[model samples]
Target: MRVQDTLKARQASIRKVVETAFKKENPPEASEIISSPHLEPLQIRDYFAGKRWWDITFQGLFDDYIGDSSACLTFMAPAGVEYYLPAYLLMAVEHYYDGGIITEDLAYRLKRSIMREDLYRMSLYSVEKKKAIVEVLVFLLKEYGDEEALEAMRAVAMHWGSDYIKAGGQELG
Candidate 1:
């Protein structure tokens, strides 16, 4: 297979695992999740999109999916993207995606696997936190089982890297 095709296969395989895990575990119900004080009315409505109440509850679902499960989307550095990105970085990616806007440089950082940067500033875009975001999402995704909910989560998660989390809970600027 061509190099590009080979890469695509790997990405697809990753998403499959995430999706399966979500279907089996099924995170907390939508009502409980939407009620989170962290999200405002607008965010809740947008998340629900008038579909099902128990949808897109696990913010972590998105994180894990792209953490390494998907290629089209990621928060971690691939083989040569930036030397290397850790598994926890996936959680950080979800955090930034949920709370902040990702930047161009940060996105590039996720694409590469050699330009390893600081983890503390990942959320602020200072060091690029896609890794953590993806990690968190993966952890959460493993808790959900509803297909609709998983898809909704993916919608938000499909746009991050898998290399944004700091190791050992280090402080960030």
Candidate 2:
């Protein structure tokens, strides 16, 4: 099938999965309504997706429930809905990296957004969160980093090389 078709199919599946998971975690009351947390992050093929996803998940949670709404809406919101999408996006990036669908110059452009600007900061409130954020960043850099960025990445790799090696991944010479 075409790429768009694949994306649409994936998106539909994501919508279903997200909805189901939402219901399971927060089981809808007899009388309730739920808004869709933005899934734009999963849509972006590059850094844009990461930025969008983080923005929507955090802002949506903060906005819809924090100050204005009643306790019902606040409790009704799908709290952990944002978690799974990041992993899905990261896995997609991993596939792209393993197949070399990226480059250094592209990596530089990508980082600005991956780090998140004009949107929420790239964070998940813990080391696991930071690691997830960084995993996407590193996956992109490995695939597209230009010499300058690659040099920067190399510096990081050098620092982390031992860790990487210990993880059974190759070290960059």
Candidate 3:
């Protein structure tokens, strides 16, 4: 199937899955939403398909509910929804370095996000999150990063790497 057609189908599936998960009458657990059988297949498909596909899937997560809750979005990590969302976004950024497409808006958002102190601090707390942030920043450096973004990402990599190493984390190499 054409890439656009496949992406559209995945977008629809993501919307349905997220809506069901957030049902007011009986909301599913965060873990349930993250690991849903229905959603996982689509996530895996998007990750493997290409960055453009994955971006569309990621975009579906930002419905009215999420948009209104943007201020609390980062704090929602403990609830699992925020925690798992970045993994897909990071995969999209990583795939961009592998000849995948990243839309200009997505790239711009990433450029701005990487500069936020909260995001940088969040990465310091989890090895997975730190690694994913580093990978995306590295990819962005080669693709969309300007001098300032490159500098910021480099500082982040150095600080996060040192902290992770001190915590006995293995090198990403």
Candidate 4:
């Protein structure tokens, strides 16, 4: 398939996961985050409050908080991470080239999250969510060849290989 078609399919897959796994989820409250004083959790909360994850367009995130979408991923509660991750993944997919450091930051953060075993914990992500994440990681690995994506997938294969395989992910080196 064409790249455009692939992107559209990935978008549709992500949307389906968002709809199924994250339906009716609320954004993180200021108190739920552990941001530095400068980052200001309240501002982050205010930006996301009253909005579903799907409602948050990538272009409109964190204009005041350092102009980086990755900041939103940092210090977020697991629930908040669950809510906001799809937007990040979508941004990484759609804006991979023009997005500058944002895409790399997304990959790095995701790598860190997976390395910490936070994202792969069964308590945090359901099987369906894990499957969706694997698909996204596969796309990042195959399409972008991002080092962080490779590291993240390696972590998954090392620690959560069973789950990864069950999620329909191929083995990684």
Candidate 5:
């Protein structure tokens, strides 16, 4: 087989493994808790137990995706790029913690959408709305973040370089 074909086969095998793992039926406890909207703090705590295990793997993938996208999208506008990373993280959390808990299809779709120009452009709401969006993202990071991830997110959020939107500007500045 050609080297490229061999590599493709290996990737497909690995992807199947990960997909099967994610698609396993959730525990009754997790499903029950996640299905209910009004969870007490203790209930929330219980629901999130062991979730960080997923975070360990997910964070590395998240970093890799972000790095690849940044390099690939260098020619694209950066006005709302920073927000996309955090928002993607938030959506991943929502997908895992709320939406049927886990599905590899969702994971794949989320990663594929990360670098789309339109996704960031869709975030170009009003200035006040953008500020609110940032605030919500800060809250999500505080809730789900580890030290390294938080620092990376903070760097993205506070970046004021040429690529980043200026303070008080639209496009999630």
Candidate 6:
């Protein structure tokens, strides 16, 4: 396949997996949306208010507050993270080759969230959700060769075992 075709395939896979995995998740209540300490909480809440993950367009975001929407991920509840994660994944795939800061920030935040040591955050995900995340991480690693994705994959392997990593068709030694 051509590189474009391969990228398209990866994008399709990411969209299908994420949408399938998170389709039934409810959007976090506006009040539940949290921002990083330096960011205004109300602005973050207002931006996400009444928006479903699927409904949020990447272009429509990241313009007002920061250069990218990754800020939206910081300090959120696990449920909020679950609700909004698909958007970030989709955005990252869409912008993978733009050489833009958006994809970089998205990838960075994604790795941090996955490797987070907070048991409260880690405990909320189901096995299926975790597997889906591994799948997405594998896609990012394979498609973009992102170092962040590789580190996140290792973290997932450490936390969930190498079997989950293997399921994504990648082996970590």
Query: Would you give me the overall lDDT of model 3?
Result: 0.39
Q: Count the backbone clashes (under 3 Å) in each candidate.
A: 57, 6, 0, 0, 0, 0
Looking at model 3, the pairs that clash are none
Q: Rate the local accuracy (lDDT) of all candidates.
A: 0.31, 0.34, 0.39, 0.65, 0.34, 0.70
On residues 1-173, what C-alpha lDDT tens digit does candidate 4 reach at each position? 69779778876776676567555566666555434455455566667666667766556663444434557666566666777777777677766776666665677777677676554233357766666667777777777787677676666666566567446555655
Name the better of 1 and 5 by TM-score: 1
Top of the candidates by lDDT: 6
**Residue-by-residue lDDT tens digits, candidate 5, 40-117:** 423432423334322423444344333332222122233322322332333333433442222212333322333243
Worst ten in a row by lDDT for model 5: 68-77
Whole-model lDDT, candidate 5? 0.34
Estimate TM-scores for all models. 0.28, 0.28, 0.37, 0.76, 0.25, 0.84
For residue 164, give model 5's deviation from the true position in Å: 10
- TM-score for candidate 3, please give it: 0.37
lDDT of 3 by residue, 30-133 (tens): 44333334544334323323222223333444442233222222323233333344534443443333323332233344434444546423443445545444
Weakest lDDT window of 10 consecutive positions for candidate 6? 62-71
* lDDT of the structure predicted as candidate 6: 0.70
| C-alpha RMSD of each candidate structure in angstroms | 15.7, 13.1, 12.8, 3.2, 17.4, 2.7
Question: What is the clash count of model 3?
Answer: 0
What order do you get sorting by TM-score, best first? 6, 4, 3, 2, 1, 5
